[model samples]
Target: MTTTSSPLTQDELKAMVGQAALRYIAPGDIVGVGTGSTVNKFIDALATIKDQVRAAVSSSEASTARLQAIGIPVLDANAVEQLSVYVDGADEIDGHGYMIKGGGAALTREKIVAALAQRFVCIADESKRVATLGQFPLPVEVIPMAAQQIARRFAALGGQATLRLKDGQPLVTDNGQHILDVHGLRITDPLAFESAVNQWPGVVTVGVFAHQKASVCLLGTASGVETLTY
Candidate 1:
């Protein structure tokens, strides 16, 4: 495989990591899929192995549709007992494997599918790697009625919370929840913040993946695919 040299384009890196993720899929195993641009490339890669894997449990409707379009069966997460791997991308990832995800507004389902998988393989371009989490705004899925209250709570925590909007309207998740992207947080304690935010009323899921952190990260760099474990 020819890797892009120094000054690699984002697409090139995504494709590299996306193709590398196929190595984690075993014959007849149910794969867990997540949403986003990088994962879109992974879905494309997965199409080549459609017949080898049994089925896939997607974290969002977008991924499910893509998997089905590529001749890969999309199954309900409830029907699947075990998943060999969960492949997803992150907004920001630290060396410890903790990540800030949900930029696609699929945080709730992504977290659920991630929890069900045996291995969480985060595929991303090198730009996402960070020394600490929270450079990218952390996404928090919350009930519609609680949006303002949650925003206020995040403000109290020194975060600037903004309701995610799409096409001039509030963006709604597959679970019919709204997303609050919180900024200005340099999360030095991911586990503690994740737990604190999770206990807040009306919070569906926090973007922090501290509890279900990645088992491995396939980071695409100018040199090659750099593998990191936590």
Candidate 2:
């Protein structure tokens, strides 16, 4: 398939990557969909091949509704025993597959479904790639009652944590909790930081997905889509 010579725009490249993702998905595969612009593009591309595969489980309602609207079947996370593959977008990714997701507030469910998949394929533009995992702020969800305390706790860990808000209100997750975006973490041990945050009282979930690593990362670039395997 020939693409534009002048480098497809970011949105155009994302769409290309989304279409490319379909090739790896076989018929009768139960896939997990992650959140973000790239995944949205993937859903649009998947619509063309909805009948080519089995139903997909989405981590966010936004994606679920989009899939259904495009004639692709949608299933709940618990509805499937094992996912053949998961193609989702990531906020930031490291060489080792350590990532900071949940910019879409679906990180918790995304990670849950990803854990059950044999392979998690992270789709993103070249810009999403980072040398380290924490250059981007990490999103952590907490109960409304404890969001402040959790933010303080995250700050104490040498990171800046702010309760994510929208239009003067705290941003709430699909699980009905507030989100704290932690910035400036030099995370060498993502698992350790994940554990430390989870141990905090009233912490609902953190965006660190160290427990589930990406089997492959599809980076859409001005040049083209480059595949990275961990």
Candidate 3:
């Protein structure tokens, strides 16, 4: 007795789990769509059920367009009252619920959207589950005017930082800011790190998403989808 292949690629895996997680999505509930390959699958899945929900807010412009294209009513963030549930994908998740996000460069909006939601649901592959965060470089969204200053600050803190770029020009976020992906910050306390980065001027947002606790995490593995509750 054996099982068939769950999915061939990561995108396929995301769709399988994302559709399963839709069981929790209810009508008339405000939703937030996260940015990432996994979240892309979730968005694609949501397109099928767009008319089933009330309204949606996107963490990235890219996601908003996709949602609109599928007939999912998109709401202005300023007009939004309260988000019922925020469905996002985590770059890394530990047992304590701490996570490192922004691998897709929308950390600022992602955090904002997550905070507006009452519950945050993280969807990812098995590889994203970890005992601790910080094996990867942490992305910090910064104002273009202060990118160099921010880099100097990180250097003083004994961390190497690089400004993400596109075709010789600086990479601009959806919000029109630069991203300084800092390396070698041993984040013993993700909450503290998030605050520390926030303390900096022109620091729009950091990839460290501790405030958004995962009420539930939908993890796709070789066996199948696994739901872990916080």
Candidate whose TM-score is highest? 1
Candidate ranking under lDDT, highest first, comes to 1, 2, 3
lDDT score for candidate 2 against the true structure: 0.85
Which residue pairs of candidate 2 clash?
none
**lDDT on C-alpha atoms for all candidate structures:** 0.94, 0.85, 0.84
Candidate 1, 1-230: lDDT as tens digits: 99954687899899999999999999998999999999999999998988998899999999999999999999999998888799999999999999999999999999999999999999998999999898899999999999999999989879999999999999989999899999999999999989999999999999999998999999999889999999
Worst 10 residues of 3 by lDDT: 4-13
lDDT tens readout by residue for model 3, 1-230: 99875455777668877887788789767688888878778878887777788878999988888888888877878888778888988888887777888888998889888888888889988888887777778899998889889999988877899999789988999988889888877777888878887999989988888877688888888778888988
Tens-digit per-residue lDDT, 90-189, candidate 2: 8888888878898998888898889889999988888888887888889887888987787787778798888788999987788988888888888888
Would you list the clashing residue pairs of candidate 1?
A: none
Each prediction's total of clashing residue pairs, residues at least 3 apart in sequence or on different chains, is 0, 0, 0
User: Which whole-number lDDT from 0 to 100 does residue 3 have in model 2?
Assistant: 79
Q: Root-mean-square deviation of each candidate, in angstroms? A: 2.5, 2.7, 2.0
Model 1 ranges off by over 4 Å: 1-6
The CA root-mean-square deviation of candidate 2, after full C-alpha superposition on the true structure, stands at 2.7
Q: What is the lDDT of candidate 3?
A: 0.84
